[model samples]
Target: MYRIIGIIVTLLFIMSILLAALALLVSRISLNRHVWLAGFFAGILDFFYMPLKYFFYKFSDPRILDKWMVSLKNISNRNSFKKADRRMIIAPHCMRHMECPASSKRTGIQCVSCGKCIFSRLREDASKYGYDLYIVTGSSFVKHVIKEKSYDAALLIACDYELNKVMMGLKGKRLITYGVPMLNDGCFNTEVEYEKVIETLELFSN
Candidate 1:
């Protein structure tokens, strides 16, 4: 499956980044050795990474992304000439309603729902773009939300492993998904990048 392949690729990428970073951290002749070693390994990936991804994607669940995209197109057409202004963003981190999904939550943990997480920002972006987006807080409840009414697209901010599982069950849904891998499996360890989501949404929406 593509998930298996993706994990391997991601690991390789991570490895390269670590190697290059360590090399940069060293100094002098030792630094030169580090740089040469890191560059050699990183080069192997740098040269073939994109092409490998292309192949992997080609071999992935062929119809899943297609279907999700189609659904979005349908929603867009439904509101043709009309501005789409709704949202279905997911914020897995609801410190108020529930404890942080994962990790350690101390006395300082708080969730004012000020649209701080990727969940809130994505929702805002969805409304701005005139499409409904779902913020799936829990993977256990994913089936329920996914089967709900016609959503234009989905923005999944979950662990890399969970994303792979989610994709495993999904058939060609014509979706343009942005899988955000959290630092840890749950809210406690979860960290989000609002700017990245914004950038991705801009690319996906367009």
Candidate 2:
């Protein structure tokens, strides 16, 4: 019985490794093409994320894993997000100017349109596209933002790691998410391609 159990455990471990490898491959492919069974693969990646992150940490940049996962999730969530009627944009505070005059609140930073950063134009475009923009200082504030309002979908803008983190965090909350990764990663002075944000907004406009 002990020998039999050992064999079964070994087989299961091998199977998990194989599935994780396949999921990683598909996530990479998702960057350039549409992938079938993307949700399934994404689930496998999520399940094995810690182990994968460790592997990447030893041999490569773990941020690449986050980037690939975000791409795969975007493909999986695109149609559902497009169908959502009440959508909101959750942008990171890092994208703001070094001297941003916005006031931070429990929900997020309130953009005053001081014209010192992209938020001024982004705020206008978000209004024009019918998305309520919330510039958050961190992921913890998302709970407050959600509590203060109701939304069927969330459009996220942040670093790849934060995008994937929020996307995973919002899973099973009945809110579909789509992420637009920032141009770079940092606590301050980060940026995103304004055109990409506009493109995503138009793509899912109702």
Candidate 3:
């Protein structure tokens, strides 16, 4: 398990660095002059990157990917999604922000497992629902998962700023998103809330 996880992490790291470099290159070449065009191009990159990265994910687990992909397709095509039950919560564990302040200005790194924040609670909810909940980063990766697997929907907890970016990338997916606070002035503890997440899902579930 450790070896598999290690390999996955290493591959993901490489992919992130390469993609970040490409984005930086785009910024440098345009010199940030064509702001609107650069933004559009970035969106294109995100949408296109979804399928490409999904290939890697599927290769990691062919059977799981194959079954989930078909399920996801049906969910995406649904009009009401009333039959959906299981869902995954995508929250930023400690990767979304640089520092904290409200709870003590402790960055996500300070999470001490007191089980008070959104992390533990949401994880519990996910387990309760039999959902594969993960506190992960990367809207790109989320998009990949959406494309490759069938989930009832996602409860994505991201900062307001990244919310737009993530929405842009995930525009057509069938997720019911709940935008939460990030950065300073938020709980400042990097903790997310299960009740709030449930509230978001309830909006579409009923």
Q: What is the TM-score of each candidate against the true structure?
A: 0.43, 0.98, 0.41
Q: Which digits, one per residue and each the tens of the lDDT, describe model 1 over residues 2-62?
A: 9999999999889866664442233123312322343243234334435534644887642
Per-residue lDDT of model 3, residues 1-206, tens digit only? 99999999999888876775465355344432333344444444454445534664766633232222222322332333445665665666553244322232221222333554555555565666555655544454565456545776555566544544554555566564334434332433554454656765555453
Best-first order by lDDT: 2, 3, 1
TM-score of predicted structure 2: 0.98
Candidate 2, residues 45-121, lDDT tens digits: the string is 99999999999999999999999999999999999999998889999998989998878889999999999999999
Q: Judge candidate 3 at residue 182 and give its lDDT.
A: 44
| Model 2 regions lying over 4 Å from their true place | none
Can you give the lDDT of residue 110 in candidate 2?
99
Worst 10 residues of 2 by lDDT: 141-150
TM-score of 3: 0.41
Best by TM-score: 2
Give the Å error, residue 135, model 1.
3.5
Off by over 4 Å in 1: 1-91, 94-119, 172-176, 187-189
By TM-score rank, best first, the candidates go: 2, 1, 3
- Winner of 1 and 2 under lDDT: 2
